[model samples]
Target: MTKSLDAHYRAVVVGGGQAGLSASHYLQKLGIDHVVFEKNTVAHKWKNERWDAFCLVTPNWQCQLPDHAYDGTDPNGFMVKEEILAYVDRFVKKVNAPVFEGTSVTSLEKVGNLFRIQSSAGSVTADSVILATSLYSQPFVPRAGERLPEGITQIHTADYRNPAQLPEGAVIVVGSGQSGCQIAEDLHLAGRKVHMVTGNAPRCARFYRGRDVVDWLADVGQYDITIGHDGMAKKKHDTNHYLTGRDGGRDIDLRKFALEGMALYGRMTGVSNGKMLFQPDLKSNLDGADRVYNGINALIDRHIAEKGIDAPEGSPYVPLWEPEAETTELDLAAEGITSVIWATGFTPDWSYVGLPIFDGTGYPVQHRGVTGVEGVYVLGLPWLWTWGSGRFLSVGKDAHHVVDHLAAHLDRTRRPLKQMANG
Candidate 1:
């Protein structure tokens, strides 16, 4: 027989990161009683990110909650991983929302418009379930990753801390996202001969016209990315959005590093005799990334023009770091690279939830935040709506919308039926 608990809540939000905390804030604003289930400590990922040198892509001005904004030394300053985690913790404590930290939800099953969530601490039934887990939960490493020669050391970006933690010698950094680029930069700065395995080198601006790129986005209402369909759709194309290099307004550039000696290659194929082999798709992927960057710039230009703002003059386009193509296998022993950092991306894994609502890709099928199975909702998912809701600050307003919708649905759907025993 299943066990039972006396206490009950109107909703249960899983994960206490930015998304979950935002959701809780909104739930309270609407006077909806809810409990948060965090598998690890609050801001678990950010705390563990201790990745020697990690910072937010978006600036501090954009790092905000509904009415609460980041008030610190520099409003336009970029935030470090530790600062971001501390911000989340402070927000939770400020709200005084009931959060059950270190409690992992093992399974969530839907029965008659009421979802039963089973966790290690205990079980609770709520009218709605909010999955605040983001895309960073599951690291997306290729199948060939497992087959690499045993001599090479491999570490995922999630597990990486600093250059000191890596194996001595030349280092290979995989994936070209913000994480990958930052990791490669860190390793290279540590005087380690670094080889960057290129995937998609998207264009990124460092600062825009004397301020952080995030400030530019905010000034142009781009930071309020949560309000429009164009913003939402643009975010969906994640692979294209955050392109590499420096911002249009900054004199600094990443091309300097690539030219300095970061060996760029196509994607990795497999390893043989402790030698790493790469495929020929590197250039093409980079080309695709270029197209995406251009598209974003074009979109931003249009937005600025529509708002009748003075266009900042200068080379908006950052020069590409074109690498010479030479197909060859690399032997680590000769190169002296003891550690490999996998800057590969992340994916959402909802396998433990056991929910009936899922698409062909095993992702939850929902209209907005509502799932097909009643009483089940999802929050904090990147690009959950059109644009703003997935990112940290952008998700706040969206979370409010979700809470209101859920509150109405709960009142309308939930009846005076007997509560099932918690298991």
Candidate 2:
């Protein structure tokens, strides 16, 4: 039997990830009556979806939530997946957030002046709704994956737990993003032959001169730079830097991977005659990555020189190009590659929300989290307000902004009701 209950709230948040929790904190601070509906436990993605070896790419100092920032001794260190989950748990307890665990929202529709939210636990009517589900709700594997051989196993990065979960044979890791490079490294280190489809993803050295590259970027306000300005949308959609937080923070350059015995190929185009087809653009991809890598180092160097700060001189990161094995096609069966892991990235799932606020690309049509429709907002989306909006370092800031907008909206909506009651 479907259990049903009726409830009302001033605002309702749809997810319980970092974005949702951050929004809850601000909403509470603003004295707003709200509830967070999470399909699973708090920080569910960190607890359930990520691999065991997963560690935050950003340093601990960047793990700032609403009122809880990292105050530990290892501010420079990275927190593993378990540590991230526990940190969120502690934050939820500290804030005493009104989060309903295991309550999945099935449908969200605007009914007259109120937003009707149907969840597993019950239905909620709210004056405002904040979709904090972040951008990674759905794993995206290209349609070409469906045509792989029946005997080979295929898995997306979201479903990948560890190398042991895979069958014992060579593995082809598609996409040269952070996840793809890291997984390929894991498989290679686990004694499994690994093949990777390299792309034009940027690479950053873990450390440049005297500090982490992330710190340098932060100091220069690189992350604070807003996207969609001067043709940055294409760069924003590019695959993330080929970097890893594993092995105590290090760069995972694809060229190095190639030198280390991992078969490297260009981007996978399609499957033809039971063989995976790839473009002969490996050198171009390597050059693109090198451009970004050297660009950052140059920025750091310029910063040091301009600020008159004493820093050790560092050489520019040169591309490690290999001339051998420049093939554009691979026979899956002939190479003994038994598994294909797609780390192509993710897309947001908002099918349940029957709102016309989304653009043609399925992304929310909003300006800094405020949708065109009144009382509907989205948080933790890339370029919501800035490049860092979706990151942990800036999610709280975005949440606070969204909450302020929501509060003002409520004040406007409730003023007439109060005036009518008083009259």
Candidate 3:
């Protein structure tokens, strides 16, 4: 049963995903009077949004909570959806967090020295606010999709469950990111003909030598590196490298799928009259993805050589197949494409917060989750502090950092900001 929130708290944590729950864990340990306001239930997105076969993209060992790391036997193996949710459930129980599930914070504004949060239940005030809401809350579908004939069914990746759920005909999948390529393969494996549009998203091998590529990279101190380490803060916006944790873990080779009869094209420019128009960059896109796959393997090889590590010898990835000719347009009706899946991606929705902490693009301007505002912090967003800030591998660490800074601020004042505000 959910608990009714009090009129006030020393701190308020928004969002109930790993980020919020992790913050709750730290706050509880320090005996801080705080409440976590979850718009939905705990682990809401993980429970509802993921597909049937969805599993962790990284290894299970990466599932680090505040103190309760994954104790499951298969540290190297990835947990499927059920196991993933169970893990989160256990963490919630372990924390014994004061989480107000199903409460939505509609708006947030600074009232004098205190923070006033307008919520679905009513209003509340707090000395400090921690936003654990991530940026990928809203799924995006292009408006040009409206031009498609009504006969064809269109859905975003979030809505995709299985091939059997779709119409019994060839499916057109746009955007070759992790979701796009994986869903295309899922449909193709189900004997559904897939007409896929490629994007510039890169690919990497799941295992290069003896262990998972992530294991190798972690050994080389890659995940520990902060965002913008290579002068590429933009890398945060780059699509995740195409791979899968399904059936343990493995690489997702789009070229191999192409060789197996999946029709590949470049980006979908628009729908003209009744046909789907595409950009003329299929060849370059495929080549670029392959280049990244091979490059990652090369880096692993260099690491092995430098450390004199006894690992299996490896070589660059060889393309299984290539486009014989560029395909710039697709006739949906002629090709019998009855369904279209837009695996495009998502954007953040932080408009509820009435604060001047956002940039021109509306992204929060924070340093390791600390906003310029004295009593507010943002956590669990991509590139908030590092490459893994929004990922299971690093969200807990990021949460700890946020809570530590917030705890110190409260300690220094030795009184609630609301008390100061009233005076």
What stretches of model 2 exceed 4 Å from their correct place?
A: 1-6, 233-236, 415-423
Q: What TM-score fits each model? A: 0.86, 0.93, 0.95
Candidate 3 on 1-423: residue-level lDDT in tens?
A: 347868988899999988998888888767789988888888888888878888888999998877888999999999998999899888878887788888888999999989999888878999899998888788899888999998889999988888888978899999999988888888988899999999899998898888899999998887888875778577667788899988888999888888889899988899977799999999899999989889888888899999999998798887789788888888889999999999999988797899889988888888889999988999898877777888888888888888888887997766533211110
RMSD of 1: 5.3
Candidate 3: lDDT of 155? 91
Clashing pairs in 3: none
TM-score of candidate 3 on Cα atoms, chains taken together: 0.95
Question: Which ten residues in a row are the worst by lDDT in model 2?
Answer: 414-423
RMSD of each: 5.3, 4.0, 3.7
Ranking by TM-score: 3, 2, 1
Ten contiguous residues with the weakest lDDT in model 3: 414-423
Per-residue error at 158 for model 1, in Å?
1.2
lDDT of 1 at 194: 86
Give the Å error, residue 179, model 2: 0.9
